[model samples]
Target: MIGRYIWEISELRRSHHGLTLNELNERWERSSLYDGREIIRKTWYSHREQIASQLGIIIECDKRTNRYYIAYEDTIGRPDIQNWLLNSFAVGNMLMQGKDLKGRISYERIPSGYDYLTDIIEAMRENRIISISYQSYWKDEPSEFELMPYALKVFKQRWYLVGANVAFEGIRIYGLDRIKNIEITQQKFKMPKSFDVEELFEPYYGVSLVDGEVEKVRIKVYDNQAKYFRSLKLHESQEEIKTTPEYSIFEYHIKPTFEFEQELLSHGESVEVLEPAYLRERIKKRLEWSLEHYK
Candidate 1:
């Protein structure tokens, strides 16, 4: 019930320019989730506080207009934490309302790793170390190690942990799904003041890091595929360098990592690597190998 209220209030405030207390209550009463009574002033204030504290969203009232509006509308975090939380709850609310439509509405199932999220997040919050027995796809056996949990990221429906291996020199990323077991340690460590997760992963696509420099990569996306690229960029550094009726040339300053190569290959022949001879050659060789399988 509380989740529904939060989602309703957040959605209402987001859609409108501003709303007065009476105006908000009126809309709430009209909502399908509305109970018998209207939201009293005290309850509304409590909800506002909960929303701000729990979701990092603030509902502020305009002193002059006497209207309430959501502050920090456009400044959501890089990972879009606010939207992610709200959207997740919104989906839950929808599921509750439309339980009969379960078969009709499909969702991409996240394979594994969500079970470890809470523990990892707790470790990250306290700046504590985590010991995990991890199974790597490349290795035959599981390896145990202690890691200083720094951040968690999701890509392609899989959760990944970015942390420092206490016994190793550089930072490492481990897929949560690959973790066989995990435990939070009593020992704590200081998170480096200079460490920024976004900055660390900015030059690469996905969580996979490669032994290469950030190079200027350009790709020509042909026909309708260019529209998809424009709507949802492949990378933050992506920019449309040139455009014509037939195709659009997009540029990025990123490492041509293995994950990135796979993403380009997923687009099939719609995308062609135009710059960086090495990356183009690599892609060409990959396509040749793929073709050989068909032959």
Candidate 2:
């Protein structure tokens, strides 16, 4: 509690003498007993020496006005401590929302699982293949598979492990949530030196990768759906060619995968296939099949 008080006083000094004792007391009474009026003055006076000795933060109370302020600006400038103080509020908010955000209990959630992930990161760094009990949507069974975990990425709300299987197979993406267990093996493999994570996903939207030849695709958007496409970018490869009053035309130089088609279909009639006649026919067939469900 004393540590938190000193930290808060230091923060107040950074923000230019925030609140008077009465105002701070009002704010504290709403959140915790630490903010109570009876003990606050006594607590500050007694804790000041201890705070200065332990944390190097000197708390000062003005003689005439009796307002409190932190006097140690020099100590607050440390980079490591500054970074911790900056992110501490955000961490506290996520952990505890009911009480005062700062006074919440500190818990090391990720530190508990650090050993496994650290080993995995080290294996990736060392160009080693890991054997893990991998499970996914395609297979109902859990089996041992050797994977070269190249990039670990968190997208949406889940983590994805992207790499190739030891069978010299194509690049595969695995959801970390579904990974039952992992063990870093002694066997080392070469991560493709040619691969760049940013460039790998440039043409594709979301997690899906385009393995085949890239193709140029043109689509026309109509109605308010054009507004949706205007604000939201589908792919980095997309280029705006022309626009009519009622429609907007966009060309994406990317591989036409199942994922790309699904995205277009999601917007329905508001979006149309323009230049590629083959893609138009495919969309028509899918829409026809979709309409049959209602019939």
Candidate 3:
């Protein structure tokens, strides 16, 4: 299993060079391994040789240059290699576009209730409502919800159900795993007027609703954490302004939702609320209240 994972990492590194040895080792360590042993550096190097031999490509190394790259025109004209590279690149791009890049978690099993998912997707296309017995994590309650299914979204190895609630008469997002039972109803639903998925999720970081009202909120992040946010954009509405040598400011025009607040708080001391007195006070109060637990 370790050998296979090493081969996969080597393949990924070959496609995108400039991966350091430490980075490769850290990625392997983060993997879900049955045996609690570190993958030795020598093992990865040996597996690279095996992979090159199996693929009929010579592995070249430059110790002085400290570079690793695939540099051969042997099968450049082959359609099979071209198609393989295309599919690999497309998968990589999709993962990069997703929100859970840092977690880097992976699942290696076929989903069980795919038929049910397929039926719901088809019902959504047919403008139908679904009566679902959903188990919500927030309330831990298995309640029935008549959802006007709009679209299905997969994020971070999990599926999401996005639709309008028949009972609440508003939009809602549900996780597929939390659903206990689902049945398509005869009653149909018309989607909200001019509902665009891209426009809907533009202001928020996750799959959440964004009302028309926008708040100009300022957040201060440490230089190191700010660098991370610079490369990986959290929201499209985020704009950066340098504040000082130790910290920088990010401005966002977003609806202040519970999920958005959780995201900001996740950075902890690495980030702080700067503007919108109401938001700053909220964060400050939460910090003070949370301090009670530590004491």
Candidate 4:
């Protein structure tokens, strides 16, 4: 019931711009989840506190307009994990209310590794180590190891754990789907003060880190394909260096890793690597290899 109210209050504030206590209550009274009793100011304040603490959403008042609104609206959208959490709850709440329309709604099924998320998150929070039996795609058998959990990332509807292997000296990314079994340990490890997950990943395109120098890379995206790159950037360093009626040239300071090359290849003929002659040659070779298969 409280979960439903949280979603309602959040949705109301997000869509309406802002609302006063009375304005909020008026809408709540008419809401589908509303009970016979009216929500007093005390209860409303309690709900506000719960929303902030549980969802990391802040409801602050605009003193000039005397209306309540969601704070850090721009910042909230920046973190993908936080956004996913809020969206999950909001969707669950909506699904509960619309039980009759069960078959009407469709969702993408994310593959395995969900079972390990809670344990991994707890381990990360407590700064403890985790034991995992992982099955790598290239390997024939599962291997057990202990990891100092650092951070979690979701990309392309898949979850990945970025952590340090206790027996090894460097950080590595593990796909959750590949984890056969996992257990959290009571033993704690201090996360490195110098380690910044964002900084670590800033130079790459995907979760897989490749060993290479970051180069000044440019790609020419043609026709309608330019709109997709414009709306959804290929990389954070992406900048429109040149524009024409037929195409647009986007530049980036990135490592042309295997994942990055695959991404560029996904665009096929629509994208052409302009600079970094080696990367261009690499892409050309891959395309030629692909062409041979078709022929």
Local distance difference test, each candidate: 0.84, 0.70, 0.69, 0.84
lDDT of 4 by residue, 19-90 (tens): 877877777686667776776779778887888766677778888988887665544435665566667667
Kindly give the stretch of ten consecutive residues in candidate 1 with the minimal lDDT sum.
Answer: 72-81
Q: Candidate 4: where is the Cα deviation over 4 Å?
A: 1-6, 29-38, 62-66, 73-104
The deviation in Å at residue 277 for candidate 1 is 1.2
Q: Residues 17-105, candidate 1, lDDT per residue (tens digit)?
A: 78888888787786566777887889888888887776677788889988887775644454466667667666766666566666888
Judging by TM-score against the true structure, name the best candidate.
1
Superposed by TM-score, candidate 2 places the C-alpha of residue 140 at a distance from the truth, in angstroms, of 2.4
Best by lDDT: 1
Clash pairs detected, candidate 1 = none
Report the Cα lDDT for residue 142, model 2.
Answer: 88
Root-mean-square deviation (CA) per prediction: 2.6, 9.8, 11.8, 3.1
TM-score of each: 0.88, 0.60, 0.59, 0.86
Q: Which of candidates 1 and 2 reaches a greater TM-score?
A: 1
- Cα TM-score of candidate 2: 0.60
Summarize candidate 3's per-residue lDDT along 1-295 as a digit string, tens digits.
4335334544454456644555555655654432565546687577667755554344455677564444454554444454454455446544544435566857477444454687697787789989999877777679987888887665445678888888786679988877888888889888776876556666666666767677888899996899888887777778897767899899888878777777788899999998889989998888888899999
Question: 2 or 4: which has the higher TM-score?
Answer: 4
- lDDT for 234 (candidate 2): 85
Q: How accurate is candidate 4 locally (lDDT)?
A: 0.84
